[model samples]
Target: MRLVVFDVDGTLVDSQADILASMVDAFAAVGLDAPARQDILGIVGLSLPVAMEALVADADHARMVEAYKGSYAKLRLSKGASSSPLYPGARAALDRLQAQDDILLGVATGKSKRGLDGLIEAHGLNGMFVTRQVADFHPSKPHPSMLRAALEESGVETADAVMIGDTSFDARMAHAAGMPFLGVGWGYHAPSQLDGARAILNDFSELDDALNALWTD
Candidate 1:
């Protein structure tokens, strides 16, 4: 079976507004100035502690992480998950891929298992992915541990797997794991930053075509 692994935030879902807002609140709660929006967006695919470290110097990393999680949860409760919507055509692409018996879906994300679980349930995507790798169980993006675990759990070869995401972190992780990477242009990082991607897709409509080409070629 061909394995298709996806990244969560900024890739499958556009959670920029909520992420940035919560980050701002997290920093504020800790009596610190928040990083710029662009700075926060640049680190979207990283685990919270690592991202927090980059955003705040010499602060209590664990406390910031907890504060960020609490702030994010509170924001979600108030604004609802509606603030983070699936990009146009995302569902269609997933549907088409899921219908193919040879294509097995998986997720390798920096989100916690709880966070990823909520997202899948919120989107009614239960049981769609055969493997779920989260930050809770592995090192952050670009470390290749998550992708490695995903491949091992799914029993899929690197040559038969492809990583789809929207950031350089994802591309780097895929490359490090010896998996082909396909990047989406609509996410956090710039298309230019996706240097190692086999192809940079402009829209979800192009996903299948790109995947097909990757597998065939």
Candidate 2:
């Protein structure tokens, strides 16, 4: 059996508006200016603490993290699943992939447990993932801790698993875990930055062929 792990933020859903809004609120709450939009996008796959630190290393990261979560929750409450709608064809792609008996679906994300669960529930993706790795239990992306834990829990070797994500962080983490990496073109990072990805999928519609190309090699 093969394991397919996905990154949530940019890969599965387009949560950029909520992310940017909450980030602005978080920084404002702490009397700090938020980073530029591009800069914020650059850290999409990182945990709150890590992202906060990257934006403003000297700021109150703990407070900012809490503020970000609070703001995000409010936004989610007000907007519902539309705030982070699955990209066009995302659900269809996921359904197709999940239907494969030999493929096990999992998620490795920088989102917290509550955040991940809420998104999954709102998007009607409950129970779709076999292994859920959240930032609550891992160091951060590019660390390989989350991917390693997912592999161990699934009883799958690194070679039989692939990490699908939208950032260099995901590619780096897959490399660290000795796993193959697949990148999404519509995510925050440019396709050029997805170093070491076996393939870069332009859209969910191309998912099957991209995976086939990667595994066929």
Candidate 3:
């Protein structure tokens, strides 16, 4: 089976507003200056601790992570369900891919299992993924641990899998895992930052054709 692994944050869902707001709350809670939005988005796909480290520098990593999670959760509760909306055409692309008999969908994301689960439920994406790898179980992006686990779980070879994400971390992770990378332009990082992607998708409408091109032998 051919496997398609997706990154969650900036790839599938446009959670940038909530992410940035929660990050500001997290830093403020710890009496630290919030990092710039660009800087925060730069570390989008890494594990929270690593991302926090890059943003906060000398702060208590554990505390910052907790604060961030709490602040984010509070924001979600207070702001209603509109915090993260799927990018345009994301659901359509997923539906199209899911209709294919030979394709097995999976998720390799920096989000915790609970976070991913909430997203899936909130977005009505139940049963769309055959494999799910999250930050709770593996190293952050560019490490290949999550990708490797997803491939093994889905019984797909690296050569038969493609990593779809918006960050350089995602491209590097796919490279390390020996899988092709497809970058989405609407996500956190710039298209230029997604080095090694077979092609950077400029529009979600182009996703089906891009996936076909990458998955073709």
Who wins the lDDT comparison?
2
lDDT of 3: 0.88
Per-model TM-score versus the true fold: 0.97, 0.98, 0.96
Residue-wise C-alpha lDDT for candidate 3, range 180-211, written one tens digit per residue: 99998889899998998899888779988887
Q: Which candidate is the best by TM-score?
A: 2
Q: State each candidate's clash count.
A: 0, 0, 0
Give candidate 1's error at residue 188 in angstroms: 0.7
The reply for model 1, stretches above 4 Å from the true place, is none
- For all candidates in order, the CA lDDT equals 0.88, 0.93, 0.88
lDDT per residue as tens, model 1, 163-191? 99999999999989989999999999999
Q: Give the local distance difference test score of model 2.
A: 0.93
| Model 3 bad stretches (over 4 Å) | none
Question: Candidate 1's error at 31, in angstroms?
Answer: 0.5
Task: Report the C-alpha displacement of residue 85, candidate 3, in angstroms.
Answer: 0.3
Q: How does residue 139 of candidate 2 score in lDDT?
A: 97
| Candidate 2 local lDDT, 20-84, one digit each (tens) | 99999999988988889999999999999999998997888899999999999988888889989
